[model samples]
Target: MFNLSYTKSFMIKQKFTIEVKIIFLILTTVTVVISLLILFFTTKEKELLITLGISPKEIELFINRVSQELILFLGITILVLLIILSILVKKILSPIFKLSLATRTVASGNLDYPIELKTQDEIGEIAKDFTVIERSLKATIRDLRERNKEIELLSKITTKMTTRLNSQEIIGLIIEDLTTELGYDYILVSKLSEDGEYSQDHIFSGDTQMKQAIEDILEEKIENIKAPVSKLPFLPDVSSGKIVIKERLADFIGEVIGESQSDAIQLMLGAKNFVDVPLHIKEKPTYLLLIATSKETITKHDKDILHTFMRAASIGLENALLYEEKTRWADELEKKVEERTKELEEMTAKIAHQEKMVALGTMASRMSHELKNPLAIIRSNVYFLKKKVPMELMKYLDMIGRAEERSNIVVEETMGFVKGVSLKKELANINDCIEEALRSLSHELKKVEVEKEFSEDIPSVLIDVHWIHNLFTNIFINAVQAMEEEGVFHPEGELIGKITIKSCVVNSNIEVSISDTGKGVPQDIKDRIFDPFFGTKIRGTGLGLSISREIIEKHKGSINVFNNESGGATFTVVIPIPE
Candidate 1:
């Protein structure tokens, strides 16, 4: 059958001529019609001439005249028919030719051009079909481009995760990326206990209203759990693999732990409309990735990709946990060994020295306060003297100014060691503090092209305004210094420097994060950033962050540092919302 098919195709290619066949058909029909007309005319003429008894010469002349006229008429009619046929063929084939060219263009991966032929014919129908094909092709290309972008972003995130080696940061990146790219309103990451209890560790990209709602649910559950047996009997068990009522859980876990249930329910509700994947470690449930979206349904392909990511993330998480645990154990063992050695070598001397140091610290605190007022007065006097001093005396005034500033810094550092000293706290807008700090450094910020993204609805917190200002100023100064050291400052070109101030509520506390686009602190030095006298600068007075930490702590707050994923450092401060 195959050989016959091949032979038939070969024969047709060699023997067939479509043009010849069409020409032959036209010629044959024309010849037949002409012959019939000639016969009919001849018969009619013979009958008429015979009836009239016409002479032979006259008949011959009439026949000759009629033959010439018939030849002329046939030639004119054939020429007109051929012209009409040529026009008809051109009209019929023009659209098809355009469509063929369009198809070839599309095949070469150009969908920008469409077949633009409008006719009320079969060709018009083909054009419509081509439009549909073109739309579909464009959509496919767009989807591919979007997917490629997502993959590239994910790759960068993964690389950052590996280098940072911080689990919290990794989860943060995941939540942020998922919410931004996937259009999710809320993302919750939870870990399940061996007995089925769920502990949600992170919630990202949720509005304040949603955060409050989730918090209320958790609080109600927690309060119920804390009630006496007479009020509530059983604790809500989320880990039981069954959805339990939030109110019921209040009975099991104390209000503190029960309130966590509301967060779980919020997650469950989101999971129902979105995607939920369990992160597992060694066949045990370790974490859950909950994505809540406004979308009606998740496509199967999206689910497949999410599931694959979940699997990979689960492995990565388990490995990270193991590494962390091992490191923790090693650290504890080393600490114990150090403690034992210290105790054996200088137990008596250490105790005596500690007591002396405490006494000295107490005296230093008193002396610092006493010296601060005097230093301030001298600093003010030096400023006044700078305006009145002669050119020769100007250098002396500058020296005095430096000495005064140095003394004030020393006093502040001494005061940092003094505990339980509280500043006068007032309700303050965090944005005000941020702006004031930036204003003080406006010249530097303008040079760097500062980018501000402050949350408008951040609630006010009771804080020492001066302390907050100082804290922000110190961080800003450090960032500027880091950028200068790294040569990241671009004057004529686009500025490489960027400072971001963002505030949000986390766990009922106001959290402020200040990020700078500068070379970050090295890992070895990061943890010591808040320690006194840990400066990396040439001037080397590392008391700025130490004093900042002290001020924040005095207001019952906490501050920590982390490297931003995009080549920078971020300092995060969390303080309670004043009652």
Candidate 2:
């Protein structure tokens, strides 16, 4: 549109030009008519003026002056018209040039160029249309820039997700991008339990004070907040891969936790709107991405961007879960392989031990047969010499008898240990066997006190009475010897060592515990104490505990030793009770 003053001025200038032309035409016409009339009357008027005593020079002067005045008036009018026309043209051309310059400025990509047109003419109309085009171009460019930004953000997020395999790390990256890149006020990623019965916050970002306030209301840290799915009534639908948008932040929070806390949280967080997007892998939603913002409106473009982002996230999260599962399986398989290899090694060692023991057993049997007659003959002669020898020589004969006795005992124990004992099972009371063994070692126990606690409920068990008696005898002998070696007797020659034996029923087994007041077994060699040929004593056959273990095993029982709190060791033997 053109300006009013300029339109009026243009009209006035055109009217003035037309009037000037008209006036000039009328004057020229009038002059032509007068000349014709004067020509017609000039001859008669001139003669009349001459007859009336007028001169020829005066008449000529009058005509010439009248013609000059008319020509001068016409010249002044034409000059005035030319001046008005020039002003109108200048006014019209100035705006046209300005509009042209504006068009060029806009074409050069400067949409902010000012366009002002004062004329109400065709040029002004063109300027109006040009202003509209400039505004439209500015808006289109602005939209394009925003779209490019969203594309760049998606590209960066995709790159980051590719490098991260852990679900938590991927989640952290996503949250980081939303807050830092997209300028979100708060983000909460809640993971739904596999059973779909609970929703727990896995990661959170933004508004520390708001987070603290919500944490206080929930009585948990924001990240550790776990609430039942029933509390979040919309979770079932969300877990079904639905995206929920809530315009009222308070209502959203209320639905998530409770209405009592929603108002307070919304006030603290300055939240205006939020969106719940289900994060899925393999078509199953496992997480809910809650995005809250302070902006008054969340446009469709924002939702579209978020939707595209989550689709990529699902792929990343699925790969991450697979990687985690693969790692766990690899570790478990490695552990199983190691365990199987160790079991194989143990079996190989056990087989080698059995083979060596069989060879030793054969050699022991042969040696025992060869030495039996010599030992018998030596013992018989020693007994004969001890009686016939003089009083002074009786001590020497006694020493010989003791040496032969020790040699016979060594050969018997070696044979017993190498060749495993065969059980002659008989239903008998275990306390009776203990009593018999104690009776046989009475002479050695002269410096040791023996206490017994035999349970009244001890039942008859199917056991080899001979071997059971021998087992206790070996144990009692060892206890007695341990005390003797440590000089456990009192200075007055009184017995100080004590052996306490007890029997009880435990579970389906009979347990016998024998504790001594002597020095306990050394911890360093405790495990090897039951190994054949391993001993601490100077003259021990080293087969006592080993043979005892074999006898227990033959009876389908177990034997173990531990130090008593009192001072010495206690050997406990457990024999299963027959049903």
Candidate 3:
């Protein structure tokens, strides 16, 4: 019940295992044979001398001479045997030693070095096998590297395609990316004709010579392209809408051209390995992507990458087309709305509603086209500046970025909604914007006693300047008309009517109260004041208060009305001041 140890024991498995035993056995056998020969001759000396028919005195001399020659001959024979055995051992195992060294060299990443051993035995066969393995390993590593390069190129193309939405721009980018990745000697993109032939509208990019050669090839086969590939030198990719690659394109083209019109194609394209991928947009095959390279065989994985890139370009082009269509619709609608505006009295209220939509669309498209570029620049610059400024200044940069984002949202809303009004928001002192609004209606409000109780210490709030100006003007106009009709304003320019506007910060919000000394909002329709098309005036559009409420809510603010205890109605507006 013990764990077995791999350590060698002294008797069972000695250090001198087989090699020492072979040397020991050889020496022992040689020594014992020499000893027996000397002992047998020396012991039979008397018998051998008498048989030789010589005197006993001469017999001693003969025996001594014979023993001396025997020992010398044995010495020379043993030396020769040792030399032969040394050479034989080295010859027998030399391929094995060389094979081991070559394996180590290959393992160390020296794949360019070759394994060479010449013999006619099992060892030679083993060396040949090692040579095959070396070749296979190098091919596998090369293939893996090529696959990784293709994947990286595909990722870069994806990044570039996602940032662009225009069709031609996307196609141009695809041509550039694919040409760079595939290292094509010739790249040609041609639109297909109504008869399914290759059209002349081809986009080609690559070497000048290769492009010319490809152009010649196309010209020669111009009248024969009845199908993607019908007796064509290069097979077309009609089956899958992808590329058809031919590794032996040079030979095929040479055969087609009758070995007359040939130049560097056979040499440059290295057997004319090429691909032809069809660029399909909205499921209609329109353009063909042709590429021919000198080196690097185009595999199926590479084709897959190219196909995916082409697919993205097609989608981007479709989106661009749809946007163009939407733009056209918006323009036509605006023109119709403009014609309707001139005849507002004759047209129904439904026409007026259409005017609102037209206004929104025209403003949105114009503003989006104008502000998108600058706003993007502002946001990016602010972000860059935020990184370099001190911690204290970061808050201001962040605020500026937020303001840009809000402006972009307004642009998006205009384009996204037909009846919605988009507002460009910024931090403004409500008192100043309100003053500007009242000034916009100065001639009408001249006779009214407009009192302002503005708080100078109030924090700045984010509100749309133009929209807030309109909101204040609408209220002032309503108040002025009411007072003028009620005889609250005297004819001698004496201001008898009063309009009070006050603003102050209240618990993280800026509140503005505009109160008028006139008839209050009717009790029955007080809740419907902000409702669209609910005005009681004969010519009022009824959209003023409704739009004002929408602009307030978009800024994350609120507005409501209350009956004054003294004599009029008060309109209260609350806007948050971001901390």
Best by lDDT: 2
lDDT of every model, 2 decimals? 0.68, 0.76, 0.71
Tens digit of lDDT per residue, candidate 3, span 108-174?
6778877678897888999898889889888988988877776787677777776676666776776
Candidate 3 is scored at a TM of 0.35
Error of 3 at 504 (Å): 45
As a whole number from 0 to 100, the lDDT of residue 485 in candidate 3 is: 55
Candidate 1 per-residue lDDT, tens place, 512-550, comes to 888887889899998878866578888745778988888
Tell me the lDDT of model 3 at 254.
62
Model 1 stretches astray by more than 4 angstroms: 1-78, 108-121, 148-164, 200-212, 221-276, 296-302, 326-579
Each candidate structure's TM-score, on Cα atoms with residue i matched to residue i, is 0.37, 0.59, 0.35
Model 2: lDDT of residue 140: 87
Which regions of candidate 2 are displaced past 4 Å?
Answer: 1-114, 120-126, 152-164, 168-307, 383-409, 426-432, 442-447, 452-462, 484-496, 503-510, 522-528, 531-541, 576-579
Clashing pairs in 3: none
